[model samples]
Target: MKKRLVAVAFAASVASSFACAQTPVMFSSINLNAPHDNVVHGVRLAVLHGKVSEVKGVDFSLIGMSESDRTTGANFSIAFGANKINKEMTGVSLGWFNWNTGKATGANLGLANITHDVNGLNWSAVNYSTGTTVADVGLVSLSNKSTVQVGIFNKTKHIDAVQVGLVNCADNGFFKCFPIVNFPK
Candidate 1:
């Protein structure tokens, strides 16, 4: 708790010191939570107020980084520095939702909570149903005291991994039941 207060105080101090005009912040290196083999190196920093900034020369160093996507295709996932989360710097994570009724799909990524340095992200969404509703797809911190659904659901496929989260549950188009998502014990 003291650390968070300290961080917020530091940020406020730093932000206050900035000129009324916009200024650029430089980051030599940052650890964005991403797949180990698919880790993106060389992050670039951009200037923005309450917006997602860019980190320069960032890309996956090796194919090992992408080893987490068990079944692959064109899916939407982001590669942030190991210290990443919330492009807007909102102290939360970037959330998403994509429901396909035919085949099961899942979400997988490396996550880190800046407040607690809690690094973890894992999820899977498989299959689609008639009226399955999606929720919990928004900015959230793992150390958050309350729980909100991330909307990642599955059809029938159950999955596990070192750094993966699963979602995709049985659905009747209106409501659906998601499976249990367990983190490292």
Candidate 2:
């Protein structure tokens, strides 16, 4: 009887040890007292030569572009924070917008509203352009890329491209870089 009990206890300990080695208890949210209070928050998505239809949400900000492939209609929102969107386009079209919706005012480096890429790229902001647009405004460019600084902007359609900044409106007639709001006084 004593021998049997010892064997069972040893087996149980080994099984528990094996389970611990296979999985980390802290890695799961079960260990957290308050799941919402203790958590890293943000939104992110990356696609290379992929198709993006309708996307809408509230985030600090969002950025998408064509890799060495293509992308399509990618519409989303930047609820209440900083928004930086850029995309490299080649054979696809892009469309999107952002909006800043916070009760506490003062920080205005966010979205109000506007359309991007009414025409294709006009310059490369990441590598060679010295052009600067309103951070809180809506801008559209087919330039090599666009480095828009805002909190949000909604889109109307999906687009495609390779390394696109804003939309590839090399075709659209008047949807250019239009400012959404004026700077501070």
Candidate 3:
């Protein structure tokens, strides 16, 4: 049958060119270090340090450090720089230090912002989230489930929303520790 339809169209064109040569998309990438190219859709400029697995658009690192596994858009690091997203960061991380190990939806402006899970907003002078944090504006804010925490010092085990602090801790709230403001009463 015509040499089996030309060997099934040359085996579907060599399996679509080996799946398009395994994720090769680059619009711009200027890296000075570590293996660049697992995926980049556009714009990645890392001067001192760079590591990549995926970046959709715009990742700029100046003085040093920018790492990624998955980042959709916007990651800027400058002067004593650091930005690391190792699995998921949807957008926005401006840094003097910002880290994510998985699941960060948007906005982490940093002097140290760390995350495991954050839906949005962590403006930092040290804000840490080990799972579930919606907002933390910090001078030290830590979370396990904190919906809102504006801090001079705030800690949580579970606070559905609100802790404006001089010192506020919720080990299930209703005052496990409170000074300025703590909610869930």
Best by lDDT: 3
Query: Per-residue alpha-carbon lDDT of model 1 for 76-137, expressed as tens digits?
Result: 22332222222111112222322222222233232311221112222323212232122223
lDDT per model vs. reference: 0.27, 0.25, 0.82
lDDT of 2 by residue, 18-114 (tens): 5554221111112221112222122223221212221222122223321111122222322322222343222211223221111111112212222
TM-score of candidate 1 against the unseen true structure? 0.20
Model 1 residue runs over 4 Å out of place are 1-24, 30-80, 84-135, 138-147, 150-185
Please estimate how well model 1 matches the true structure, expressed as its whole-model Cα lDDT: 0.27
Quality of model 2 by C-alpha lDDT: 0.25
Question: Who wins the TM-score comparison?
Answer: 3
Model 2 bad stretches (over 4 Å): 1-70, 81-185
**Cα deviation of 41, candidate 3, in Å:** 23
lDDT of 3 by residue, 1-185 (tens): 99999999999998797567633333223453333356766677666667877888888877877788899989988688788898898989999999998998989998999898888899989998899988899899998898899989999899897899899998888898898988776
Between candidates 2 and 3, name the one with more favorable TM-score: 3
Better of 1 and 2 by lDDT: 1
- Cα lDDT for residue 133, candidate 1: 22
